[model samples]
Target: MPGTALIVIDMLNTYDHKDAEALVTSVRKALPGIRTLIGRARASDSPVIYVNDNFGQWRSHHGELLQAALAGHHRDLVEPIVPDEDSLFIVKARHSIFFETPLAYLLGQLGIERLVLCGQVTEQCVLYSALDAHIRHFEVIVPPDGLAHIDPALADAALQMMQRNMAATVCATDDITLDATPPVAEPDAAAG
Candidate 1:
């Protein structure tokens, strides 16, 4: 097992409400799996990195975003789902986590070579992240039930595309196992 990181993308309150309202039906199905994945990642001591969309708040601090989300509309749902102090949070201004973000830099810092990704808007953020990870030569694993998109058809299509074209191993949370070892030694590259 090489050092791998668990990337939970955009599991924010704003998105979850839309997903729950059936505006993004696929997310309803993906939540349970993502939740399970989070649990397993914590148990394995693998870093859990929450890659959140900043929603265009350039000066927005992660703590402020979290506080607002907790105090805002979906307080209850968002609070519990939000990553605790144990996890790391990185805010992004766009779809790709690696774009202008510390995500790539962080992964490099941790010597991560594999990624276990789970989260919202499967066809968009999830797909983009996986593709980026694949292109970066990171081993990508997307558990089938761990991600969702606004459109069910598109979500499924994206998953299939990732598995077929990007060499992402697709499995349900129940069937997948976490690789606990630290990533194998490699040249230290800047994470970003």
Candidate 2:
């Protein structure tokens, strides 16, 4: 049967950017919600895929990224949600998870038809990733409370666009359900 995958985007951050402080603050608030979603996804046998930024390092891998992020200032946020041994990790150089990455192909191989998007920068990476997922014919679901954003207004606008333009289901973390069943056909394909 088709399944749902929880895509955790850019949570393994070094917090070394200009808006790092603001992002960290927002991420701190969203940590618990993200953690809950991760736990639920694991319990439901849904795949937990960490799609993280490579921080401009072309040779960098998941182990290095995890170590750097955990050693950096945001250890509190990164430690609680570290990927397990069975989890999948993909490093991306761009904002979208599917941008020049094998994420779409991997999802296809795993038989994932729906994505539960969580993690940092709701306005940027998360939004772009959701759009790509929608265009690829995958169901998109974003948990607002489980996402971190540098700006509140922009984040809200991004979420609205994901809902209205991409037909993504913008839900709260508590309401999301990851199961083994495939997604039902959306009422309107144009929306997603």
Candidate 3:
């Protein structure tokens, strides 16, 4: 078990809208594992974060997007997994959550060691966040079933790149088990 933060990225309805109905199936596949991770995070008192794109909307907040998306019928595919009031939500203007957001600062404040990233568009926002996390030197893990992409081909490439180039430990969700013990990653060693 790692001193992990469950970082759910861009699992919003708007991004899923770009794909056909089949995307809902893909997203559905990831939800169970994500939900399990969330439960484990809560049990361990680990922070749960939702890092979402604001869709380049200059004045939009994460809650507003989540509310509007969940308010509609077509949002059935993703609404249930939306962040709750207790979860930390960061509205990002770019692909990388740490780019212009207070994600780094928040993680620092929480004393997080490893980051378990899961969410939508595995080739885009999730990939960028994983790379950024690797650069930040946070032990990054992306459970296979915890992520999805609009295009399967692109998703494969991104996963490979993250493993080979970015140094991410890409494992299947079933292979991981959460424990209450904190990770032994030398406290705050990744803050640089």
Overall lDDT per candidate, in order of appearance: 0.79, 0.91, 0.78
Lowest-sum lDDT 10-residue window in model 2: 180-189
Q: Write the per-residue lDDT of candidate 1 for residues 67-183, one digit (tens) a residue.
A: 766776546446546787889999988887788898888888887888998887778888988899999999999887887767778888999999999999988889767756474
Best by lDDT: 2
- Per-residue CA lDDT of model 3 for 1-192, tens digit only, reads 445788888777653354746667778888888887877777767778998877667688876778766764457656567676678988888888789899998887766768888887798888999889999988888887988777888999999999998888889877765544353346575786
Off by over 4 Å in 1: 16-20, 181-192
Global lDDT of model 2: 0.91
Candidate 3 segments exceeding 4 Å error:
15-17, 20-22, 179-192
TM-score of 3: 0.84
**Per the 3 Å backbone cut-off, how many clashing residue pairs does candidate 3 have?**
1
Residue 189 lDDT, candidate 1, scale 0-100: 81
Ranking by lDDT: 2, 1, 3
**C-alpha TM-score for every candidate:** 0.86, 0.92, 0.84
Query: Candidate 2 on 1-192: residue-level lDDT in tens?
Result: 358999999999889899999998999899999999999988987899999999888888899999999989878888999999878999998999999999988887777999999998999999999999999999999999999999999999999999999999999999998886454454686877
Better of 2 and 3 by TM-score: 2
